[model samples]
Target: MELQQMRYVLAVAETANFTRAAERCHVVQSALSHQIKRLEHELGAELFARTSRRVRLTPAGEAFLPAARQCLEAADRAAAEAAATVGEVRGRLSVGVIPTVAAVDVPAALRDLRRRHPQVRVALRTGASDDLTAEVANGRLDVAFLGLPSSSRPTGVQSHELARDHLVAVLARDHPLADGGQLDLADLSAEPFVDFPYGSAGRAQTDHAFAHAKLTRDVAFEVTDAALMAQVIRHGLAIGFLPSAYLQRAPELRGLAAITVTNAPSRVEYVVWGSPGPSPATVAFLATIGLQPTPE
Candidate 1:
């Protein structure tokens, strides 16, 4: 029996509706039915019992389902290994990203990844750190750059903490405490603060810092983008904490007064992935960002 036949069988078994299975398998219902019928003939046994309302797996189908899944998985692994060894990686790599979380130079990394693997294509999607982590866990993403807890990652996924930057408080130049040169989490306790949304790395770090000090601030706004949060700080809307790199990299941000928060938590970014065999393009992308195929 062919792999296509086995896939059709599995799809039908899962959906229990030939039409739905056919749609999922990207084939006409008639064609899928033909393949399943042909496979059953080859095996000298009927695999599915079809009725007007539903399809049920026969005893033979139930017995064959696990083996069929294993066969497809093995084929995928063999194909991946062959592609890895042949030469430059030439396939699509789906990458999920979080804003300001991983501290990666994504443009530079992509440029170098393209130079190294010209045939590879990279697809980028931006989301919250938790959302990206979920995508990585479900294998919808080949890899992601996110701010994740060191030990709370999904079971099948691995994450490596590449680097960490200290969090600093950003504020208007005219703010009362801006001239202090340095501050602490408690210093901002009375100020209405702007913060990263829950589940984002920056937000997590800030929360930990406050919790460690047994203090809480009045959060006036929750934003995911550091640039926007900085803008709010610049307008004197509220104080906010940003990775020191953000303060250093953006020229416009330099106009604002930024102070180191001695008691604030440091935010670490991670490069994370699911399973083991990533495409050549993904491996190249990782290397461009000062990483290796192995996960921590």
Candidate 2:
């Protein structure tokens, strides 16, 4: 019934261990267990099925979980809104980003936000553009940094474009075509390549480009991490395409050559938020990054 009791229950449900949950909540195990027992008694049902080894949520607990989360979220939003009325931004800002984000310096922007609004709590998550956009639309994330093919735009959310750039070919310094000259997609069609997973936005740009040119390239390796993709290209196993900014930011990848692609595929980076409108914390973050919300 009490907010603190709900916090304890949620922690226990997440960790599935009394002692660990107590540690997470900064309380002793006995105190946490006692509070949970009090809450269960008030609700007229046991929230957890306890065992010597593991703890699992009971059917009653499962039914109560979603409402509990909604209650907590509502309470937090109320407090944050009250704070914002006095020109103070104090709330939890959940942000999602793609691994290859390069339009704005995310860490620098977040650091500035922290300095400007010390009371605001910031959480960062990295994921694919598609998943990140969906999280923003679902209200699970306050903001997201995404990269999509130039032909595509994010739907169901308010977005502002950050930058657009063509991808460059990444190759080992010793590769035959690492001469720094501009090359077309057909030039690399016969060569094995390292690329993002087939269905990912990063891969789609290259795929569409090749298809438009009536060429097909063999993808010898599929990787999700940009650093790993660079390493694979550095090893001479395969060539890959990436935004030029990636090479500029990573010194370790300097040994690899980046050849300009004359007909390279291009992608656009965007900052998106839910259509419900921006929270004060989200607005502050956008300003820190030198962007304003797009009109609905």
Candidate 3:
């Protein structure tokens, strides 16, 4: 009859052990048994055949199981919808981002999100683009800011473009190509290169750039953080590609050089939602942050 009763029934059906079910449901075994007895009394039939060794569902219980599940699912959906309607977008929002985006302008976006949706708490995690994409697809994350080279058809999830960022090669100020207005892959091929971890969005871009130009790199180091890579380049260790947005934040790396790559692809950042679409707060947060909704 009640949602809690339905939930209890589902849990009992899963475990088939009163003590285990009660523990999983965070209730006392006696209370669980009493509630099941009450439910059986209301239905005028025993839902479970209890024995010393174990409990098993009865015919009636088998027939009622699907209906009980449906009832609980419907109630949960209705509650979620009602919460959205009331604009009560107040809950934990687990967000994922690639290291480049996390260090880029993504923080500015979060500041705006918090300013608009003060009640929505956020947890930020950063990883490689592939890892973030997989997490979003598998429902480990509620939403994420994923670099676009990693973007593809949203299989089992919904996604929208956040922004387009220009990709540039970061280099040491005194390096030969630094002062040259523009440099191609051929010019930098022999230059010691710092690259993103293989399989990352930035590395994908780097690979593509080299592939397009028929060039190869002598990578000296690989790192996830573009800012740190910039530092590495400053010391003339290796040079790598990063977004222009990264330049705006690193005032300390003043002597570092950034050269816009010609004929190379730019990176697009996306805001992705893990299954069941966005919560009201998330929707509003995206809108507030100016991410255009992707057509369904």
Candidate 4:
């Protein structure tokens, strides 16, 4: 019933081991076990099944875990709101970002957020579009900024369109076609390709573009890091496709040429948020970063 006891229960449920959970919670193992016992005594039900080899959540534990997390999140939000009322934004907001945004925008955006709301904290996690979307849907993240399909959208989360980024071909400086102002998909059909993983949304856009031109690329490598792919392109190992933003801040891939594919598709970057809505501190941080909500 106590908040600290609830935290202990949630930590044990998450780690599935008293010893590991204690380490995570910065407490001793015996103390963590004692708190869990107290919590189980109060509820009059066993929350976990334990053995020397492993610990697994019982049915009651499984049902209680999410509710515990929600309670903690709500409590944290309430505390943040109290702080905000005193002209301070204090709390952590976890954000999932795609590579392009991390490369081009996050540094400046984070700087602005920090200066404007010194007490507010931001944690960033980066991954491919599908992975980021899944995190947002699962309540693992407060918000996500990534390039997504224009036709599809986040199902349970709210979304806002931020900007459109063009996909262009990245080629080695020494390549003959690098000097070309614009290159068609047909022009790179036979070139060795460094591309996104096949199932990724970015890959889908790349594939769709090639299909439209009736051309297939020779993919020599499939990579997820935009900057690394740019490096591979720079070394003449393969040609790659990426948002133009990749080269703007990438130090390893300087002087790489991007030829706008006349027939290529553009990707839209959106900001998606989970339920429970943004805290006042999070709202203040977002406005500071120039991503204010649209007027009704």
Candidate 5:
């Protein structure tokens, strides 16, 4: 019934070990166990099944975990709102990003957010769009900036389009067709290819482009890091197909040329968050990106 007791129960349920749960709660094992026992006595049901090897959540525990997390999140937000009313925003803000992003000036946005909300601590997690999308839905991330398919969208979350950037062919300055100004996938069919890893959001666009042309590229390298891929292209190790904006922004690919690919698909970058309602930090960050504020 007590907020502290609710925290203890959730911790125990999450860790599945009373000792580790107590450690996480910064309390002695006996104190945490006593609180959980008191909670179970009040509910008139066992919340956990303990054995010599492991602890498993009982049916009651499984059902109670979500509500406990919601209560904690609500309490934290109430405290944050109270602080904000006094002209202070004091809370942790966690944002997720994909490996490569061209839709938003993320660094500039973060700089502005930090300037405006000095009390807010921020962290960034990077991954592919699919992985980061799941993180947002599961409440691990407050917002995610990443590339999503122009034709397909994510479920269970709200997404706002930030920008659509074309995927273009990149090659060394002296390479053949480097000065072509405009090219297509078929032009690179016989060339050594470098690209984002297959099945990724960026690679999907490139793959779709090739499939549309009925031509298969001789991809010699698949890289996830844009800087490294640019370096690979600059050395003439392989030709690359990446976001045009990304190549433009990367100083590492200074000697490379980006060819506009006619009929190519653009990687649409979007900002996404959970549907429970946008977090205050997420809304504030979006403002710098010129989005309408997410209402509470």
Candidate 6:
């Protein structure tokens, strides 16, 4: 089947509406539908089951989707590689980051990448460290910025350590323990906490520290967003832990006190990519962030 036909099929499968898919592909609905019908005929099976109100992928379509995506990606990468040889980088770069990424200025890096290689399209997403790392390893993301407890490192991917720092205790200005003194794990154990979800990499650092110190704490609020965590702390609903750099960047959280924790958990920030190596766009992005890939 033609690559354009595959593209049409993918668009239909993703949008699940022929008209919307046509709009996305910048083609008229009839043209897109005709191409999909041609492709289905060539493949000897219908790709979609359509009704007056809904369009759903048939079993044959489900089987064809993954290979179609791979084929498109391969074609794109080949074109990008050919361009790279002529001193041009042109491709899509999918990047992932944790909500509290602090080691690299992601927006600034994206700006530099745009200035240096305008042909490279960039897509950015924020997620938990483990999920981002998995996306990078699985080729869904070209690169990811992650943070995990000092005792852990990313697996199944190539990684570079970016920075390491202890997490500080964040408390509202009016909280009793907001006296700006260095506190240990035990000192904060009695206080309710606002923290990342229990199993997330962001929460693991503090959980491990508390376990190590033999202290039990209550997580009154479990939030996925760092800004929400800050708000929870600011309202005195619960205290939390965050990298000092993250706290410094959030002006709204300026009133919150970040206290030094004598036995605080530490985390390492890393930049990770797939094991096979980086695409040209990925390479340019790494360089934009001042990180050179390690030689294999």
Task: Say which candidate scores most in TM-score.
Answer: 6
Candidate 3 per-residue C-alpha lDDT over 32-51 given as tens digits, one digit per residue, 9 for 90 to 100? 88888898899999999999
Report the C-alpha lDDT of model 5 over 206-250, residue by residue, as the tens digit: 777778789887779988788888888888899887777776677
Instruction: Record all residue pairs in model 3 with backbone atoms less than 3 Å apart, i.e. clashing.
Output: none
Q: What is the alpha-carbon lDDT of model 3 when measured against the actual structure? A: 0.74
Q: For model 1, how does the per-residue alpha-carbon lDDT over 1-296 read when each residue is reduced to its tens digit? A: 89999999999999989999999999999999999999999999999998898799999999999889878856754665578787747666788877664377777788888887776777898887777877888767888887654334434677777677777788899999999877778778999989878766557777877888999878899987777887898899998887777566666576888888878667667788876666566677777877777643
Clashing pairs in 4: none
So what's the TM-score on candidate 4? 0.82
Candidate 2 accuracy as lDDT:
0.91
**Candidate 2 runs further than 4 Å off:** 294-296
The Cα error of candidate 6 at residue 165, in Å, is 0.7
Error of 4 at 77 (Å): 2.1
Worst 10 residues of 6 by lDDT: 287-296
Ten residues in sequence with the least summed lDDT for candidate 5 = 287-296
Report clashes for each candidate as comma-separated counts: 0, 0, 0, 0, 0, 0
State the C-alpha lDDT per candidate. 0.79, 0.91, 0.74, 0.79, 0.81, 0.92
Stretches of candidate 1 off by over 4 Å are 1-81, 101-103, 149-155, 294-296
The weakest ten consecutive residues by lDDT in model 1 span 147-156
lDDT, candidate 5, equals: 0.81
Q: Sort the candidates on TM-score, descending order.
A: 6, 2, 4, 5, 1, 3
**Cα lDDT of model 6 by residue, 198-280, tens digit:** 89999999999999999999998999999899889888899999998887787767888899999998999999988786888
Candidate 1 TM-score versus the reference: 0.69
Regions of candidate 4 where Cα sits further than 4 Å from its true position: 13-20, 23-29, 48-60, 102-104, 149-155, 179-181, 231-237, 294-296
Could you tell me how far off, in angstroms, the CA of residue 248 lies in candidate 6 after the best superposition? Answer: 1.0
